[model samples]
Target chain A: MGKHVITMLPGEGTGPEICEAVRRIIDHTGVEIVWEYEEIGLDCLDKYGTLLPEKTIKSIAKNKLAIKGPTTTPIGTGHKSANVTLRKMFDLYANVRPAKLIPVLKRPWDKIDILTFRENTEDSYAAIEHMVSDEVAQCLKVITWPGSYRIADFAFKWAKANGRKKIQCVHKANIMKMTDGLFLEAFREAAKKYPEIEYGDIIVDNCSMQLVRNPGQFDCLVLPNLYGDILSDLCAGLVGGLGFAPGANIGDNCAIFEAVHGSAPKYAGMKKVNPSAVLLSGVMMLRWIGENAAADKIENGMNKVLAEGKTLTYDAGGTASTDEYADAIIKAMN
Target chain B: MLTKATTGRAKRPAKPITLVGVDVYIITENGIPAFDDYGAFKIEFVSNRGTKVWPGYVSEDLMLVNWYRCRFMATKAVTDADVDSFLTQLSKKWKWSAAQKLWNYGDEAGFSKAY
Candidate 1:
């Protein structure tokens, strides 16, 4: 059988170095995979005059499955989101992030396993926004019946497939009645299709408070665009910081698993950073490509590394360099 | 204790808050002058925008401006009688049917820097 190939779009700042480490670690593990590299992030923006460059988009379009490093997003400013652009472009409407408790990590919660299946493409993140007339700026929150229903369906399918008992739909329908009201209604319609899974809705703010108070009650929480972004990151903090968080942008046929964080410019080229986010994302990549053996191997190897607490990164509370960490994992795998 | 500006010195903002072409003014909450133009003061109040500080504007249209524009309206020094007359004009023009005397939708689209 032909080897499964995946493109790695290393973006600006520390994006390239981390990608290089990911390359080295995957190669050394003898993980059956092929690499296709592309230049993205700052360099791409400078050359192509936009963050979402044609080459990167073209690469993603061809490959159908890729794992990417971080790109910077200037919040609430000029232009829209980079991730939002990709999700909308490819119709990658379901963002799936599964956070499980890594052993020996000083986390607050127990049974800390949750999958956030966020509505990926629509709502405030669409960049369909304007600062119309200096005093009053506006962002049009567009919610369609089809978009909400499909994302809800994806969440329910994921829950049922994975044996998840509860599926929570988070929204701000009480305050934002019209837009979020539509999303809640669509969630209900999709729930009818998957009656076996238990379901309920929570207000967005209360949801945040609940995650902080008790994250165990959630199995898989799904939400619209902006709410999902904030909730996912908040949930990421619950398990570990965002370094432990990994996400996948999924459409019907296309899926891009990536390290969904900013380009940490200061840590560029140091080889002292943690690559687990991208590595786990690579694990997701392996799963997507039907290389489940390699995927399990990589995950088991990672869990083995985390269990001993040997060769941990600074963020993970140790002095081990990025190479040191990956080498430790590979050693455990061996 | 009242934190007054330095004696004999007018305090200013670090950055000048310029209201571009907006005919709005704020009168200090000190002893406001009488607004009843007919009952009246000897001289008319004036602003940097050259709009008359008329204590007599009863435009139902003007009262419907947004917080951004409404907060910046030109203020004439006004007294109790001026307030009463202004309130009466506002009630009549805006057609204040309710007891509290306010409009539900205060003409958001019609609000602008002009007037």
Candidate 2:
């Protein structure tokens, strides 16, 4: 059995708690993974004077695989998101967020499965704001041909491989004619190559309305950076919430799987927050590494635990602690 | 040796800092058009990535940067809302990436390198 070395980033707040829970559950899979732990986010900021340490980045760069917990991005100012920094550092242009309905959870919509492919590198996220004067400011929204094409290509390839039938390109090209227009054009170009898959375009506003109205109609969605950031959260609402959302940032050389939810600072060290998001992210990591059997087993274990409604954390409407929840899933796996 | 008289111009309150024009960078496939009247405003000149490429330009082999900056000058001083309206109208036909407002500082231009 070959041991797979993966960089583990226990971020901030409840990040460590959930990551520990996920680590224990994954260990039971007998997958022989060597977890290289790295400290990041606020803790790293305190120790190293930077949120994202150079050493941590080098570890992930060397290992090529990382599973991370939620990190805090201070409101108003302090520092930019460490996640965004990492994404830009590795050129992780494709942000894949999968939102699937848990059968046990009672939600407004049912059978909602959506895979959001967000172009993560550019757009307003480039952080190029300039104060033109005392009364005005501007931020450059960069949308390159290469950036657009690669993300669209990744979406189509992933959709085809995952047995998805349709790919929807969501944008506000009607208003942001150039930046978003380039994105739509690239999507159309990529669609032509994947002739087997049905392709369509929708304005970002209408896409939001349609998502909430009939999420099932969308099989797979590919969008620019800003729209993807917004719609992925909206799609997460369709299934359950961010607590169950699993995200993966993938580039050519490295991939990092993470929980879409933020670090619940108030619940830090309480052992009460739900670990479903990070746990499912670990499942995604398993699949990414070709451990289909282990992935399926862990996924099935999660489904069983949720369906039983016996052992669950506070967010899931149960009294069990994070470790207890992981214990239940590990026990159920056997 | 042209020395202009600064009699009444020196007493004026620096023209109150008015918006004279705006440079709208539109992403076009075929580069900037040679003659775009814009109806209300004048299309002074067009440039590809800061190098003037249209309206009696220098080099014959001009490289298109996808982003073409078209300087549109108004007949009179315009407000911020007027600039917004102008951009809104232009967006219907051309895909614009960015717009920078050009100001007239008394006699000289506020933004450097007019063309």
User: Please, what is the TM-score per model?
Assistant: 0.73, 0.76
Query: Which parts of model 2 are misplaced by more than 4 Å?
Result: B1-115
Q: How many pairs of residues collide in model 2?
A: 0
- In order, what lDDT does every prediction score? 0.67, 0.82
Q: Which parts of model 1 have CA positions greater than 4 angstroms off?
A: A28-31, A75-80, B1-115
lDDT string for model 1 (B1-115, tens) is 4556544565432332221111113332222223332232222332111112234321111121111111122244444454455545444423322111111122232121111
Query: How many angstroms is residue A249 displaced in model 1 relative to the true structure, after the best TM-score fit?
Result: 0.7
Can you list the residue pairs that collide in candidate 1? B24-B72, B25-B73, B34-B79, B35-B78, B35-B79
Please give fnat for model 2: 0.00
Candidate 2 lDDT, tens digit per residue, A1-334?
Answer: 4899999998989999999999999999999999999989988877899888878978998898999999988775357678987776666779999988987679877678889999987777765443354344466677777788889999999988889999999999999899899999988998899999999999999999998898888889999999999999999988888889999999887899999999989999999989999988899889888998999999999899999999987777889999999999999999
User: Residue B59's C-alpha lDDT in candidate 1?
Assistant: 17
Report the error of model 2 at residue A23, Å: 0.6
Which prediction has the highest DockQ against the true structure? 2
